[model samples]
Target: MFRKASRLRLDGSPRRVVLACCCALFVAASVVSAQQPPAQRITTNFKDADITQIAEAVSMATGRTFIIDPRVRAQVTMLSSTPMTPDAFYEAFLSILQVHGFIAVPSGDVIKIVPDANARTMPGTDLPDRPPSAADEIVTQVIAIKNVSAAQLVPVLRPLIPQYGHLAAHPASNVLIISDRAANVNRIARIIRRIDQAGDSDVEVVTLQNASAVEVVRIINSLYQQQQAAEGGGANPLRLAADERSNSVLVSGDPEQRLRIKTLIAHLDTPLESGGDTQVRYLRYADAEKVAALLKEQVTGIAQAAAPGGGQQAAPPQQQIDRNTTIIADPETNALVITAPPKVMKSLMSIVDKLDIRRMQVLIEAIIVEVQADKTAELGVNWAAWSEDDDTRFPAGGFISPVGGSSLVNLAQLAADPEAAAEAGIGIPNGTTLGIGRIAGTGVNFAAMLRALRGDANTNVLATPSAVTMDNQEAELKVAQEVPFITGQFTNTGAGGTLNPFQTIQREEVGTILKVTPQGGSWRT
Candidate 1:
């Protein structure tokens, strides 16, 4: 029984060994099969076939699924004389499709076949009919550029992108974002890479400390014009933009051009002394019109006098006005904004000081008179009327022209005939006349003309000067007069001197004082 059992066990061991070996061999074969490439050979000929059918045959041979867009309805004819590998077949097929305005795009294991014009329009099976999200089919790339503002590069890069592509640049961030098909995105990347490899130009920002924004802009524009004229037809290499808010200039170009501009700006914007190259003078009490006129006239006169002919054969108008100087008068602020070189600004300030100095003060005395109704006709004469023989019309020795609508006449005639003067609207009831005189140097002669007119009993002067004080460019005058007592009769206790009891005198005083200053060669009170 033992011998029989031994034989059975030995047979079982052999069978088990054979089974283990067979399993090992099967696993090895499976691994080899998995590691091997799939068969991609094909042989085909078609007299005339729809492009869809051709795509289908190629897909079947290569074991790759191909989807034909419903919009593709074109038919094609082809002949493949010999069998070809999957790679070669794909290349040949794509070439043939390209000839017929079609393309094949791969999506993972699947291929999309469509007309070239409809490639972007065709919708994917799983994708909705909306535009492709940038996260999906389109690739987004952010590139950093050095020494160039994004705004400056956008124009140069825009035309390089495909029509369906999108490009945007953030100037502050100095980053460029591009969204497009993978191929186009790659192309743009290569382009940017090439540009970066070519080396970047320098971008500089220069702030103007002593230069006006207007002057800087003018200089830049003039330089650009000259550059354009020299270049004739080509684009200007240098680009300049002025920022008035920051009072700065931005420059971009090649190294040499940028250096040239920088040097030019530096030379033009050299700093002046501690006081600066510009000066703003405020005309406190002067009219801006008169000041500006005086400045122009005086500056022109000085320039002409300095010329060869002693104010004759003047220089051209353009040459007379210095280009480096700028004067802006702001009437709202009553200020003269002057910008120029140091010497020129100094000269302008001196001129302003001279023109704004205060000179002499003149005291004007005007007497207002009211005549009685019965005596008004005797004073019927126009005080402002002047004839060829009337040389002494004004006490100060100037012809007194009628102001407003009042007619000028002889005062002597008015004194002779007061009744006629009232008939001519000279001193009638509410009518008034002015006896005006001026004291040139010193001593206020208040009512001097009125005292002279007092010889006629009909004349009545209403106001008189009480005191006059003359300062450098100003004067103060006070006039005191007697007021007629209406019905009250009282003794004057404050009257220290002798009183005129016959005239029934009561005191009434009226005076006006003003400070006068000379502005732009004219007196302002």
Candidate 2:
């Protein structure tokens, strides 16, 4: 039983009845106390009452101590249809404080109510097992992060916590100190366990066969620094170390990163050849001369940029050109003739691989046909036509008609108006050049469409020519025979004043010829 004779409050303040039910509960407290189960059941129906009055009543029933700070003042309204056990009632009380931006922190033997922002500074229950706290009850947890450095997780996890929540990392111990609501702390802990795994990260020792371990490490670090600066990133996670004692390099990072390091090491650690050798590198896509010039410029720039040891000046541009490198392009074979040591050759070949990519090409296919439009050549279809004589040719499958004559449809003009053409059961998209069923052309705003109407369509294929051309380039196809014609007035005579039988004549080539400048930019979609 609680001491009701003392009209003093739980915090030494005078109590006031906030509602009629408040006094009734205090009056019937003796009866309700007798009915309290092992887990004290609470039947609460709080109105717009001071939260302090509610806390005082809880202390009277449960015998647990509670200290409400002077700054804590708010009105609460809660109603429970049925009774709640001690644990449930406790959670409910904590929630009321949390709704007012306060937290219930268990300090020493008594629970202290304070602002959530100051909960971390006050004494609280330490839960290491990370059991989720009840309601919004603030708790402290020291979580030990494994596999990864705990400090690394702080920056990633800080944004997830609230402003009043506290989160810190101990680098030496690789542990995280989190002071927030119990549920939130436990949530952050689960996230840490998921990402803290040391997945496929290890150290590999690469023995140097020819190259210096220190020099290899220096090149790798230099490239990494350049990339990092370009991307504006944090410190590199990879650790590269040179072991002079064993002439080996130690790489520590993810397995994929280590594989890349090993590949670079393999290329750099090759035995130097005895002397210079010649090799022909055929250019497949890029021009040999252009590639050779680019190589000369790059190699010379590297030499001139390189500083000599002991603070000596670098070699001049002209002198750097002959630094054990000789490159020439053979126009006949479109190949590069290189003369250099094995190490230099290997480096040059790698550059060639990146530069010699096949450019986009367009395949232009064409068919030249003379579809016999007349009946005699139409492969059987004859069209009626009016003519004065009986020998006149018929174009389609119709006999002569006495009534006027049928005019052929102007296909090119009809195609220009898509709306009108659709009424005729045949129409293409507006601004379309050509379409054969589903096959269509993607114009680069330069191609023109040429279409004509034919009857029965007897097709006599004259020639089919196709050519491959580079982007934005042109190609020509011609199938013709040379014909000789008289050019100069000369009699048929021999060398000795006798007329030559073949008389001076000029030979001219005339037949089917096609030229197309394909602009293949539209295919990218």
RMSD of each: 28.5, 30.2
- Global Cα lDDT for candidate 2: 0.67
Q: What is the Cα-based lDDT of residue 267 in candidate 2?
A: 94
lDDT of 2 by residue, 1-525 (tens): 222222333333344444545645643562375257666566776766667666766665566678777777777777777877655666787888888888888877778877777887886767646556444767778887666656667889999888778888775566788888887887887898788776667889999866667778988999886544433221225679998657799998767678888998999888654444467889889899989999888777756565465556555433433467889999889999987655466567778888897767888898888876653211111122223334543222232221111111223335467567667665433221331111113311111232223335477888888998887678988778899998767556567896654457899998988889887665752
TM-score of candidate 1 relative to the true fold: 0.37
Angstrom error at residue 181, model 2: 2.0
TM per prediction:
0.37, 0.42
Off by over 4 Å in 1: 1-49, 58-67, 70-96, 105-112, 121-188, 197-213, 218-252, 255-301, 304-332, 337-525
Clash number by candidate, in order: 23, 9
